[model samples]
Target chain A: MNVVEVTNICKTYPAFFLNRVSFSLEGGKITGFIGRNGAGKTTTIKSMLNLVHTDSGEIAYFGMPLIGHETEIKQRIGYSTGTISWYPRKTIHEIVDVTKTFYTHWDEEAYRRYMTLFNLDESKKPIELSEGMKVKFNLLLALSHGAEVLILDEPTSGLDPFSRDELLELFTTLKEHGVTILFSTHITSDLERCADNIIYISHGEIRAACSKDEFMENYGQPGDTLEEIFLRQEREERK
Target chain B: MNALLKKEMRLSAMLLTYLFIGFGLMALLPGYPILCGVFFITLGIYQSFQNAREANDILYSTLLPVAKRDVVKGKYQFVILIELCGFTVMAMMTILRMTILADSPVYRQNVLMNANPFFLGMVLLIFGLFNVIFLGGFFKTAYSIGKPFLIYIFAAFLTIGLAETLHHIPGLSALNAFGFDHIVLQISLFLCGILIYAALTWLSYRKACTDFDKIDL
Candidate 1:
């Protein structure tokens, strides 16, 4: 079953437009969403989450439309925006204390575990944390809520290599536990390591959507890395 | 919606939002227009919105387990909550002015806007204007504050000037009635203000929700 199905979603900006984007993520699979900057990766994800209203089309989660089932659907989905400039004066503990009230499935023990694992101080505010730490804190909140599907945008950016590897392992473990992920980033190496599917977008349009082996076969040569494939695809599109 | 409101109280509200209710006591001050008291109240709310925008409060709230429309609803709820709270304090002061101090020489001699139901009604009207003008206008772009706030400031001060100047006009002196001189009419004016407040605030909320839903951010 498809964990998420985005059908022909379109969003237009004065300078840029997300045109007729469509894709589906299979249940319990890690789908890597790859794009260069200004490629509408964020816009498409935001539209799917209904954070940005689409001009036309539908986004569904678990076979239910997002419009009527927004609160219910969002409850089961974990979205961590790379930016965490919200309530910068509030401490992490305070933010979490308030956030946990919205979800009936909040797991306090898991929250505590992620907090420790991320080495975050409860008293620290978002303003005081490093960008990478902010991302981890957001991921912690996403993970703590028992979300079945994680929609993460650049969740690994600003992390050290060791931390990034640790996160990749965590994603692998979460997948084994039946958690589906749509990981959006320009980091092709991360996708090369663990992604089962690829959804490559460029110029505000989806360029490819397929399983990993199929994507590599169609776009890559023998021993070619995911980065090489991405570069080649982008060059061809521009030409 | 309740959960979103609690989040606003805990996360987005500024410290001055609570403390500025004291400004309502300006209702009792002689020689100054009581209408300006609630203006101070709106100023506190204005500052909070400014700060919230800087911190991207709307983005954070939208990401939570709530609908995007609910984010706008929660903000309106918070604003109305603060407006009513400050109004309560002002009401107390207005009551005091209408009772024991009704016959006081200082109040009787004051040329400024008197503490009466008409005055209270004017304050409510100004607040309603703020809702539709400032708050609703902010949702148009969902990020810019200067334009909406400027429009609100113009509207609020114009309301204040009208309220202060109305009693001075020929044959309109009864609007300045004190010590229950025109209690029934004064109460009716106050009630009308309440109705307009309710209607305009409701209208603003609907418009804001619609505007916010169209925004990409």
Candidate 2:
């Protein structure tokens, strides 16, 4: 079953537009939403989450319209944003306390375990924590909710090499537990390691969608990295 | 709604401390009959503006399995909760100041001044103003499509100014004098103010939910 299905979604702004974008994430699979900075990847995610209004289109989660089924849809999904900010004064424990009221499947033991693993001091305010720690905190909250689907936007934008590797391992564990993941990022290395399916978006459109093996077979060379293939594809699309 | 209300109440508690300090300083002066009233009014307006600036936090909030209307309602309740808390604190301080000043010989000569109705009138006026300010501000913040603080300030200044001017009129003075002793009239006006606020709150919630539905995020 598809966890998310977006069709013919469009949203126009002054300088950019999301034009008739469509995609889907299957249950028990990790899908990477790949696009350049201005390719409307975030816009597409926002539309699917109903954060912004679409010009025209249909979006469904578990075969139900997202408009009326927001509560049900959100209950089964965990979401994090790239640029979203948390209150500076709130400690991780306080944030967790508040968030616990919203989700029925919240796992206190899992949350505490992640806190220990991430070395997150629940007493420290969010502003006092490093960017990597903040990201880890966000991931912990999403995961501890026991959500069936995780929708992360640029979840690894500012992390050290060690932290990035640990996050990938965490994602693997999540996938093994039957949780589907749909994440967007400019970091192709992370996607290559963690994503099973790829949705390549460029210029507000889906340039390609395929499995990781197919993506590698279609564009790979002996020494070509995913970044090189992406650059080459972007250059060809500009012509 | 309870979670959101709790959050707002906590924020209100923090803001109320600031308001009390300011009001306490004003109480030190003599002949400040309207200080409590103006304080509550200004505090309500300020809280509404601050809420508008922080509206983007709703992106994370809306992720919960709650209706958009509930989110908007939660916000409106927060504003109202702040207004009530601020007013209650101000009222307590006013009574305290009145008792302190009444015991002092310097203020005995001005005992009639102490009986000024402006504080009560100001409370009613501020409650009405807060309703209007919150409704206008929330609509702008939710839509992400307008100047929320500007609308709030304009409405607040206009209503307060107009109400103050009309209260000073000769004809309105008679209505005010009669209302001082008429329990029914006082109760009716109070209820009217509350009903108007409730209606505006509902309207704001409906608009915000519709706006959220349209948002692409």
User: Which candidate number maximizes TM-score?
Assistant: 1
Model 2 spans with C-alpha error above 4 angstroms: B10-30, B33-56, B89-122, B143-147, B154-168, B175-192, B211-217
For candidate 1, the C-alpha RMSD (Å) to the true structure equals 1.4
TM accuracy, model 1: 0.97
Q: What is the lDDT of residue B79 in candidate 2?
A: 60
Tens-place lDDT per residue, model 1, B1-217, is 5888888888888898888878999998998888888989999998888888877889888888888888999999999999999889888988999999999999999999899898888888989999999999999988888898899999999889988898999988989999899889899999999999999999999999989988877
Per-residue lDDT over A1-239 for candidate 2, one digit per residue giving the tens place of the 0 to 100 score: 78788898988899887888888888888899888989988888878777778889999988899988998888888887646656655677777787787888889999889988888998997778788888888888888889898999999888899998998888888899899999899899999899999999998888778887788779777677788889989888889
lDDT for position B26 in model 1: 95
The prediction achieving the highest DockQ against the true structure is 1
Worst 10 residues of 1 chain A by lDDT: A80-89
Q: Clash number for every model?
A: 0, 8
